[model samples]
Target: MDKSLEKSLTLWLKQQQTVCAGYLKLTVLFGILTGLCLLAQAYTLASVLDGLIMQQLSLLTFYPELIALLSLTIFRALLAYAKESSGFIAGKKLRAQVRQTVLNKLISLGPSFINTKPAGTWANIVLEQIEDLHDFYAKYLPAMMLAGFIPLIILAAIVPINWLSAMILLVTAPLIPLFMVLVGMGAAEANRKNFSALQQLNGHFLDSLRGLRTLILFHRQQAEIDKIANVSNDVKQRTMSVLSLAFLSSAVLEFFAAISIAILAVYFGFSFLGHLEWGSFSLLPPTEHRLSLFSGLFVLLLAPEFYQPLKDLGTHYHAKAKAIGAAESLVTLLNIQDSSLTSHITTSLIASSKASHTKIDLKTWELEANNLKVFTHDGECLLGPISFTISGQQKLAVVGASGSGKTTLVNLLLGFLPYEGSLKIQGIEFNQLDLSHWRNNLAWLGQEPQLFHGTLMDNLRLGNQTLSTEKAWELLAKANIDDFVSQHPLGLKLSIGEQAAGISVGQAQRIALARALSRDANVFILDEPTASLDSASADAITQSLTKETTAKCLLIVTHKLSQLGAMDTILVLEKGQLNSSGSYDELMAQNGLFCQLNAQTAYDIDLQTSLGLNS
Candidate 1:
């Protein structure tokens, strides 16, 4: 990782600590208490040994010290448990906060931006990548703090007993973290590659599953399987590389700690044998400078405890690297600025500007567009500087060839895309209105109706949960699917599996239409609602839509020119510009794009009939 980027990620991670700071503080407190208990336990054990050897005391005479040691041992265990529990709580809260933040950002970006990436890519980031951050909060952060504080606590107790042993510990302590950082630098890079590979695998696997039917129809399933296997293998290799680096880091820390402890043990052994004694705190003469067994035993007992924190820190260093790797994707997504949806004006101002606020009267609503153009993030125009007007209770159809920006125009109206020039709703600038409020006044249906896994009643009442069962039947009747739903064994209780698994596509579209009508929106926008339906189903939907939207403004984007003849006004688009705008009969009379589109539609129908595909 680059130095600056690493620093930024570290800062970002530290900032998130504020969300669960109390729990984290408790973790560190319990850890410090555990360290104190270790110091007390070592002292009591050292005193007992000194009394038995130097004072020639019996085991019965040291009952108090033995009992104190036992009590300290149990207290240390309890403190350790509390530390872990606090860390777990802190990690859980932080993950939830971060996950909600990511979800909110995705929602604000809207479908226009979200559709740019595969569904699995977003799911991977939101779930697996966020999960990888757990250990950093739960283990690494508290350990980092304790690694500094605990080692110092041990040194404080050891220094007075033997300065040389304390100096040895101080010298070796820096080495553990130094090598840990060196190993972690490589580990961080490996972890980053591993996360990237996992994201790719997730996205590819999900996309393959979604397109499995198409792949089988073309006899390409085997090739897709091979590709998936290759991606999975790559992820496995990268994951192993990360694990290898983590193990290497632990090995390095253990090697240095064992060497440091061995050196302390050798010093104590020599001092006990009267070979060297100046390092110990004894007041004997120069030639008879001898170390007491109590001091030597105390220093030796605290030796391993001194290096324990640093070793544990080295072990959890890999968690820091893993979290930094996961944070890369998270930060990138959260930092994305969807300039189109952002507005400096407050919602209150936007709402208060109109007397009726968000609740505009549906009967008198008017939409006007002048020189309207939609632009991509790069400022490239997707929809042109065209103009149109929709007045009270008007039915308009926008017809165009593929890539002619028909969907872009609808997206602009739905507030999913930003536009330049004048777009006004009831004389108010469209951009100045609160989007959430604006969306409430509009209902939309796309080519593929998104029916989730739920009962028919649950799906229908999505926009209006308080809707009565009687009102729901009325909506189904309006969409012309009441008979089909009523005939089912469960009626409104009928369960529609994910993506309408048990229902035909036409029936799903009708159910979606009923759900949309349940919103009682002032404006209705349908984009190819009947594109894949049979003639009978399509005609029924068209008739239901015409009847239901009679009192509301309707805009339909379609290629079937036959049903469009009844549209009050039709706008023909070629490329990104509007070729012409008139009634269907008026456009048919002219030798323009509309006539060519109508001729193409007729040809497609004849071709389908001859092939018996329409049956």
Candidate 2:
């Protein structure tokens, strides 16, 4: 591989070693002990064979050596078991740590980072990419050290018996690694491209699945299938390339190992035939330098052992390449620094702010802003240079067309996105307060409520799980879904699909409302809550929204302009700027954006109804 990549991989491995030092030390210790056991077994077996063949000693006479061999074999087995079990634990711990690090980094990057990629791309990075590093930790890293040390131990045992064979083994060992480096360069690059292709294919397939209905309606299903197939073919080619290089590297190592072992055997054969006097350690006359059966057998036995560690090194070489490929992405992700904040306004500064020092928890919760602005990653403004104030238990509606930044306002309030300009809560800077603490006091319900696979009771208890069953039932009654839930045979224990199965979207939204009520939050922000509901459901929800915030501060973002008549204030946004702000009648009297949106609702409702009927 290139120097830069090699250095990066080395650095990353060293960092991992530091994180998992105890386990890796255990691995190396077990590995070296296993090598010692192998030597004992080999030496004992050779001694027994020599005793039988040359001295004509009885098999029964070799009992002690045989027992020693059996004992080493059992100990080796136990060592192997411990190595494997410990390696698994180490890999699990590393994977969990890496996954959590990625999750935390993603959170620090916020929703903008999430919006930049497809769900499957993130899935491939978070799940498959992290999982691919398991072997790197469990095997490749420890094997790297063992591969160098174990062979030296075997060579030390052999040099006294047959220095020539040890010399041959040492000379040939570098060729395997030299060839490996050459082969591994291509394999590393191929593996990286393969992972990228797989991620793209997954992302494309996921996007297609999410938009399947639209594609079907437009008669583009066959086209999508063909595109997916092409991406699959690309992945197949990339995978084959990686495998070919890996196989080639393994073959090269095996060939060199086989040659070294054969050379050792040949030298022992010639020495026994009196063809050479200098091959063995004894340097007397030709007859004196002759091979002793035990000496020759032991040297031959050591040949494979000398080459075995090198052979293992070849196996782990591919793992190193794979890890290097994975590390490139990991390094890039970890290096991301949020550019939105100014040079002095660090994330740590914002995070360390105390909420308890402020009067934000007062009964009269007040929010004041002065020219708040939000920007996309590319520096394009998405919201603001607009200002507003909200106080007491008031219901307010923010209305705008698509891309006008209505949702951005709520995102700012929820602390999902950062903003410029002063936003104060109870006369204290909002950014100076602990956001996680701030968020707990404010309830947010989005366009869709994420209901997991669980009992109805489990889903409903989401907002305030500490509530008693009877108390939870009361909140459900307030949400107007208690009657339907009570009539169901399974009652609170009714099983539901994750995708709002066995219940309508309206019911899911109601369950979300009930969850909000259970929390008994002082502030509630609803983002297009009834956007997906039918007219009857929508009207019912609109009516519910009016009554839902009797003693709570409610902020609503909706295109349903009719519902804003009872709202304390109606804020109109046009192209990220605040166009108007007043009650519904006041805006109508001004003949501003509110009246224009009111005029468009007639067509919107008609178009929606027609589309609904057609579908």
Candidate 3:
């Protein structure tokens, strides 16, 4: 195994105390019963042979030996069943516990961190890799412990009767496991690569499926199919290579084990035939002789069974390698540190510390930014060194072209990422405030609203679960979606597909707006919430928002030139730099870019409206 994989495996095993100990005990007990059964079978065979050789073959005379063999077989089967059942229980419970722990990590990591990871990778970790632990727990690990302990038991049982046979068996048995360790390591590496390829293929397939419409529009469907086919072929080739390695390793182990057992059989047979050292105890067979022969034969029979566990272990090694690769990725994802303005939650996972610190020194009501800087992952600066403030329930409109860092600014304030320089709310340092509590005091509606797999009411309940159905209808009435939701046969029970596939984009936006309103947060950030709605719907939403019931701060980011008139203050951003800031007339009076841009926007809107081209 790779060093990292070995370390992780060690960590995983150490943590599973009760489960591992239970499995170990059960396995040993089963192995003991199985070894005893082999002993009984060998002794009965020798006793019956000696009786027949001496012309004393009678079923009634050998009744005791037959009964002993039958009892041992029955007990061994019962013990084996118990071992399997206990293993199943342990595997199930451990999978559940580990799964819950992983989920908790995902939840605590929050959306920002999760967004950075691929959905396919997350699916593989949670669904596939965690499930792979079952094979190791239920099958391979038990057999490994048995492999080590059973050989010693067999050697001890035969040592007194025939030391030469015991020596041969004991000396050569370790060769199988040793050879496995050296040759099977390659299979582990190949299996890890296969799993990674599989994950990439899955990710590519899902992404293509999601963007199938875009592919058809661009006439790239056949190209995508060919690309996926190539990935499939690569996966198949890698899988076959890994399985071939497993097969070769098993064959090697079988050959070594069979040869070792054959050598032991030769030594025992020679001694019994008076061609080798006929010790005083060994020379007493044939009705009164060969007592030692019975024990040696029994040890010989069990020697192969002992090595069979090792062969099975070789196969599981391949499965376990794939599982470990998936697990390593999962551990990294689950342990991703949430280092933003949001509060950090620490846990005893990964090697990282759980320390929560805050930037203190600002008050909670005064908004100010000093020398702020934000950079993208690729090292391109989005915003920087810009200072501004919004105080006392003020409404500010942020306007700019599409790529001028408008959304990036909102992300900064939402505490999704870290920034340089100082940002304060009410003079309280933005980082010092408890982020979860701070977020609870804010509500946001982005250009695209996210809806999960649930009913409209069920999704809405995420905002305020205590709200009654009657109250929900009232909120929907305000957002102008009451009729649409009510018209459905199931009404509140009407199910939405994943990502709100059943709803139009406009309706999804309305539901998001309703969700924000339900929170009743002190600060509301609307990032072009009306971007997708129809004219009448947009007008109704803007009107409803304007009639605010509470004194709350509002910041709206929009490219809707017509909506500029509604803002108490309008701010313009150009090339990530704030160019103009003031009330509508105040900026337009200066007649800078803001005035020129507004004029061009109005002219275009008028033309589109006249030509019946605006959607």
Highest lDDT: give the candidate number: 1
Per-residue lDDT over 134-191 for candidate 1, one digit per residue giving the tens place of the 0 to 100 score: 8899999999999989999998887766788889889988999999988777677788
Candidate 2, residues 1-615: lDDT per residue as tens digits? 577876876687568656677898898889899888888888888899988988899999999988898888899999989987777777777888888888877775556557788888889889998888888888887888888889899888878777887789889888878887877777777878988898899899999987888999999999999999999999999898999898998998888888877887788888788887676776322236677887788877877877777777788889877877776667666654434344323221122223243435845878888977875533456788899989868888999898899877887777656567788888887767766667678788877677778988887777777878898787777777888889999888988886677787778887887777677678889888877666666676777767877877889999888867789988899999999999989999999778989889767888978888412
Residue-pair clashes per prediction, in order, are 0, 0, 12
Local lDDT at 246 for model 1: 86
TM-scores of all predicted structures: 0.91, 0.89, 0.82
Please give the ranking of all candidate structures by TM-score, highest first, separated by commas. 1, 2, 3
lDDT of each: 0.83, 0.79, 0.71
Backbone clashes in model 1, listed as residue pairs: none
Candidate 1: residue 525 Cα off by (Å): 2.0
Off by over 4 Å in 1: 282-289, 338-363, 377-380, 426-429
What value does the lDDT take at residue 137 in candidate 3?
A: 72
What does candidate 3's lDDT look like per residue over 219-240, in tens digits? 9999999999999999999989
CA error at residue 498 for candidate 1, angstroms: 1.9
For candidate 1, the per-residue lDDT at 303 reads 82
